[model samples]
Target chain A: MLKDMKELFKEQWEHHNLIFRMAKFEVKGMYQIHYLGSIWQFINPIIQVGIYFVVFGIGLRGGRPIDGDIPFLLWLLMGLIPWFFISPTMVQGSNSIYQKVNLVSKMNFPVSLLPTIRIVGNSFQFLALLVVLFIITLLYGIFPSVQLLQLPYYLLSMYMFLFAFTIWSSTIATLIRDYQNLLQSMMRMILYLSPILWDPMGDRVPDWLGNILKLNPFYYIIEGIRSSFLGGDWFFEDPIYLLYFWTLTFIMLYFGSRMHFRFRKDFVDYL
Target chain B: MAKVEFKNVSKVYDMYAKQSDKLLDLLSIRSKKSTKQFWALRDISFEVNDGETIGIVGLNGSGKSTISNILAQVIQPSSGEVTINGVTSLIAISAGLNNNLNGYENIDLKCMMHGLTVEEIEAVKPSIIDFADIGEHINQPVKNYSSGMRSRLGFAIAVHTDPDILIIDEALSVGDSTFANKCLLKMEEFKQQGKTIFFISHSAKQMKTFCDRVLWVHYGRLKNFGAKKRVLGNYVEFTEWFDQLSEEEKKKYKQNMLRKQYTVQEKTKRKQADKKNKWTAFGHLAMFIPLLVLGALIVLGY
Candidate 1:
């Protein structure tokens, strides 16, 4: 098992350049058919944020504030940016291997790199959305602080967690078509279940249940990014939650790499 | 040293009734075993020395493509040992070219996948384009290329990659005779450079002229393997005799050979069942062990 994990990492590391190049090509290809080209990446997210801001911020919250001083739109933007990155990645990453079976099967290509390519490809759009979030925050007079430096830490955490999850999910989805559908439904469920749209920490919800909801890994990420962007406690301040998140990630990675190496040789056969 | 050697190589494909059953069997949860198995290659073994141009002759569905895929490391055999000494490139029709990417982009991507440095790709770019002869269409998406044009680009990229073992699987059949002649000349140059080549083609005349040896595959088994003169002679004679048969007789002959290729013995079936049971049990264990460890660790609070 250790050897398999090592091999997976080493393969990705050795092919780092190729992965980046492919990711760039994929991001470009996604918008290639459109006359607008890559502009749609930003446009789609901005439109999503606008609708969510209208419905949840104005329609639901009555243009109120979240957690006292933070305006509802700013708070939603922080969570929505991360949520936007995570959502499509889950759907697309799970289908990455099956979608590229024709391309990868023709040569001695590393099938595992497909999910990473998906993540990195979506990161381009995520980065653009992130800049929009930063600009909006700055406009609201939230200057950069030491807490902002932790943004990278949270971003890396999100990437690692998503990588672990997608590696497992993509392998399962490739083997079982039903699982892909399950993943799509599950992502929709998670959007409502997690605190992206509604604040679990609000007065309407009880503290104990909200704490339990924080156990959801996405909750940890969304809350972490919110805290980093808006100036809150250091990530190290919450040792237990930190330990829990990384433990879950490594555990997922363990199972993912195990199943990946075991079944990847025959993945084409399944197709 | 032998450039390529296959020791008792065999490839068996499990026939799944449904995708759900495939998942269940993979997770070791399926109650009933799949009864259908296709043996694409059965206990076939051969060895090739450096610079040997070997031709494979077989009727359709005789597993010639399977051999090429395995040799190219694009697929793995079910059982046996395959030792390949160097990089193997399989140039089938539009094998690795991405249709959405332009011709130049496909060349860059495929060449990069083969580990060519940027400078090296640049160095070979002109020759590949010149050989493919697609002209201004090189900037156009590959989906726009005709079948012949696609194969030309594929062939050009594979040959320029400088693989040690080149397997051409009917890629020449798509192009015109002029391009075919050009490829044959390039292949002769490869032979002079001592690179082993595996050629799979239906044209016996071309095989006779190009290959040093011939491998005759008859329904997943090696019917003959020897110098081109003897093996090609026997293959050509057999093909001629088989063609003279009535259509019904030919169909019956093919069905009989196919039946022999796919049936598994009761002993092997039982063995495979036991192995599946063990794997399923392991799958259950693997599924739970991680959650168990994670829960335990969280409880312990690191």
Candidate 2:
């Protein structure tokens, strides 16, 4: 088992750099066709944020402050930043294998690399949104603290979780194409279900409901980020939750790797 | 040196019809209406040593692609195993390429797919671009490319990867004579470099020139695997006999195929119309299902 783990890790490392390059190429390729080009990456998301701020923040009265802490706009932006990272990462990642059926079948390389590329691409978009988040936070006078140093750890946790989920979804989607549609629906549900736009603490829901909400890995990630930036106490302070998150991530990673390795050989036949 | 071995390998495909067929089959309560198993390849075994250029020649549906796929590790044998000593690249030119991606991005993606790092891809990108020779259209989507352009780009990328085992599946035929010659030269260079090549092509002349050995497959069975001249000559003889069949014999052959493919009643109509137009028979048989159900019900007093 130790030897297997070592081999898997080595393979992952070798493929990771390739994934990164492909991801960058995909993002660049997307921009190449349009007249506006790479500017659209910045422009497109800003437009989306602007529309959300106007509709959800102002029009739907989401603009009003919630939890008597962060402004509604600021709260929405905070959640949106992570969601921006999570949703696209998951959705695109889920469909990544199916979309690249051609590459998966003909190439002898690891199939896990394709979904990794999708996650990496989404992460770049997340970084762009992070810039926007920083600008907004600076304007609001919510400056970074020593706790902000912990941002990398939180981001690492989020990355691990997203990677695990992407792998799981990519593998599952290859077997059952309906899983892609299911993923889109689930992501849409999670957008509202998770405490992205609303604070579960403020809503005062039943204990069982809140407990169930905690079961969501994204909930922990979002809470972890909120704790770091918003000065909220560490929601994941309990070593148990950290262990639980990591354990689940590892399990998913194992299953994902197994699925990719097992089914990869027959993918061309199906495709 | 790269070597590939398929030991006692077999592949069986479980053929399942759509949901409607299942529902109808269930309603009819017939076991015959259920799924079927097709063995595309069975108990096939072969080994190709390093630097051996083996040509595979076979009629359509003779498991040529299946064998190539297995060698490329694109598909596993249902039974037994395939072991490879080095990196294998399958030049399924059109199949592996993303039509939506431009030529440059496609090459980059292909490089990445072949397990090249970013820096490595960047370094080799210029050579791939120059070799493809598609001009500025390299920035355009590959879907817009003609078949020749796609083949050129694919061949260029595959050649640049420097694979230890290169498997080509009828991709060379897409390009013009000039480009095809370039591809052949590249294959020759790969052979000189001691790379294992499994080439599948219908062109007997090309295969004779390039391959040191030949594997002839017929109806998913290996007919011969030996020296190119001997095996290919035998394969040509077999095809010649098939081609010499009379029109009546051809009709009987097609009818036999239809019987194996369709239900009993559909087979009769297909056999009857085989002489006139086989396609018309298929059209009639396609519509015969509903009409047959009605006729059978009336005759049986259902």
Candidate 3:
């Protein structure tokens, strides 16, 4: 099993260019279905941001800033953008194996590329939204800070974390048909717990509870982005969260990989 | 001497009552309810050397497709192993073409997947285009293409990629006569280039025209695998003898060849045990409600 996992990694490495191009095609394929096409990528996120800002920012919080002086919209977006990237990647990546079956079943390609293609496809959209993030920050009168340089690192780590969950969910979802539905509902709940709408750093949350919530792997990525936007602590300032997050992420990654290797041969039978 | 080899490979698929049965069987360390195991191919072994043209011939439901699918690595064997010396390209009816993408883009996409670079694909694109001869429709989505056009495009991409082994299964028959002639010439060229080919067809004429050796598979077993004349001779004799058998005799012959995995008595025993197991499960849940009620009554001083 260990050797097989190593072979998988090697195959993935050797086919990195092919995976990247296929991801480009996948993203193209997604927009190809829509009449408005690639414009919807921006429009859909804008609409999501609009509804979220109105609901949580105006209706619930009375348009008041959740994090002191950081506008509710900016704070919400810092969380929402990452949430947007993570949620879709997880959902779509889980379905990637089934969705790409036609493209792959006839030809020879690295099957590992299927899940990662979702990630790569989503990353292009995520980068586009990052531009929206900067535009949103500028509107809030927040100047670009040097801490923003660490954005790529946070993006990398966050994708790694989500990619682990994505492949894990994809593999398990194939075995148990209900797992896909379960993940859909779970992602909805996770959105609330992820400190997106509510600020964990605020006085509203108890320090002990807030500290535990910070231990959530999503919170680490969200807070990292927040720190970049609001110009707060550098990511590594608190090394324990970084260490804790990596430890959890690595365990999940290994477990996810093991599940993929075991179930991969049996996928045709199940499908 | 062997470019492709199978060492006693057998693929047994578990025929389940439902999808959940598979899940249950996987979860349980020891299954209480047995699954019916159907051996798609049983203890089959064969070898084909470089530059050989082998035809797989069999009657319907004789595991010919299963063997080809295994060779193409679409499905794996339940036991034993398959060793292929070099890359094998499978060109079937579907041939893994993404329907959403245009024919031209798909060519690049599939070639890239096969580890060809842009330069390599560009070098081969004109010939694939020439062979397929679909003209401006090459830019159209593959879904829009006719089955013949799809096969043409698939064949064009597959043969042009320069694979060491080629497996073609009933795919080329969909095209027009002209395209079929073109494909035949291309296949002849491949043979001249000394590549191994596994061609499967129902028509004995095609087999006789192309194959250096013929494998006659009957009911998942290799009835014969030898040179063109011998296996074909045996297959002809078998068919003649089978044709002579009466209706009842033929049915019995089939049943004997493909035996039932479980007897009727064993099936009924399993059904009875399943009923008992379900009762115990319901009993556990049914007992829980009253036990909870009794505990509640005691706690409330009833």
DockQ of 2: 0.16
Candidate by candidate, in order, the iRMS in Å equals 4.2, 19.5, 12.8
Residues A1-271, candidate 2: write the lDDT tens digits.
2343355567769776666777887787777768898887678667777887888778876467877757888887788788877888888888887787666666666666777787887778788778788788889988876667667888999988887788777877876666689889888998887877666666567655665566577877887887777776664556556655676677667666666666666565554
* lDDT per model vs. reference: 0.86, 0.76, 0.81
Per-residue C-alpha lDDT of model 3 across residues B160-267, encoded as one tens digit per residue: 888989998887778887987788788899999999999988777778888999999888888899998888888878888999999999999988877842222122
- DockQ for candidate 1, C-alpha atoms: 0.41
Query: Candidate 1, A56: how far from true, in Å?
Result: 1.7
lDDT of 1 by residue, B235-270 (tens): 889999999999999999999999998774232233
Return the number of clashes found in candidate 2: 1
Q: Which is superior by lDDT, 2 or 3?
A: 3
Over 4 Å off, model 1: A105-108, B265-302
Give the number of the best model, judged by DockQ: 1
- On lDDT, the stronger of 1 and 2 is 1
Could you give candidate 1's per-residue lDDT for residues A1-271 as a string of tens digits? 4777788888889899989988987876567667888888878878988998999999999999998888998888888888989999989999999888766766666899999999999998889889888999999999877898998999999999999998898888888888889888989999987889889889998766676676689988999898888888899998777877887888788789888999888887766
Question: How well does model 1 score by local distance difference test?
Answer: 0.86
What is the C-alpha interface RMSD of model 2? 19.5
TM-score of chain A of each: 0.97, 0.90, 0.93
Q: How are the candidates ranked when ordered by TM-score, highest leading?
A: 1, 3, 2
Report the number of the highest-lDDT candidate. 1
- Colliding residue pairs in candidate 3: none
